[model samples]
Target: DAGITQSPRHKVTETGTPVTLRCHQTENHRYMYWYRQDPGHGLRLIHYSYGVKDTDKGEVSDGYSVSRSKTEDFLLTLESATSSQTSVYFCAISEGLAGGTQYFGPGTRLLVL
Candidate 1:
């Protein structure tokens, strides 16, 4: 697991509720990414953090937000859960933005009804 962690690996919730997913890494890598996997979408980046307190939005960042207060932790939150948000989310870590292999943690499966 490379010291990477995700909380509540499986969750089921109502559409209007708020949901938060967490990703923690002990590797202390420079780049951490959040991605969602769905049937047709394959894998889409949701958000990413390059350093403590430095984060950026990704293609599917419409209803999501992320925070990184330390080198080892990254947090993702959904303001309002929706059925369309149901998917497997993965957290990845990399040493560099380009050319480095990104190691992924076991995904968190979320179902919004």
Candidate 2:
């Protein structure tokens, strides 16, 4: 990755193992999204939640699950992650709708070996 984030920002994990990444925001934005950025794919949405406990699957939702038990926190879990799932994951928060301006957090680079 770009090496802009902190220590846990760059993670190296193995395949078939469960991985959970958290995005916590103190702003309490209404819309939160989890997106993965790859070389060719650019950024693909994995999941997004509008409110606490109200979530919707995105285009690349397969093999991924999300939970939003609180408005300030969003969790993205990969059940038995595979090599194909290795990418830079990002969490974005927006006050308006989906197309509105979004503030993105530092990416978490996950390398599944």
- Local accuracy of candidate 2 as per-residue lDDT tens digits, 1-113: 21122125888899999999988887768899999999988999999999999999998999999999998889999999999999999988887888668888898999999
Q: Largest lDDT belongs to which candidate?
A: 1
Clashing pairs in 2: none
Which residue runs of candidate 2 sit more than 4 Å off their true CA positions?
A: 1-7
lDDT tens digits by residue: candidate 1, 4-54: 888879999999999999998999898999999999779999999889999
For all candidates, what are the clash counts?
Answer: 0, 0
* Window of ten residues with lowest summed lDDT in model 1: 94-103
TM-score of 1: 0.95
- Deviation from native of the Cα of residue 14 in model 1, angstroms: 0.7
Candidate 2, residue 29: Cα displacement in angstroms equals 0.5
The 10-residue segment of model 2 with minimum total lDDT is 1-10
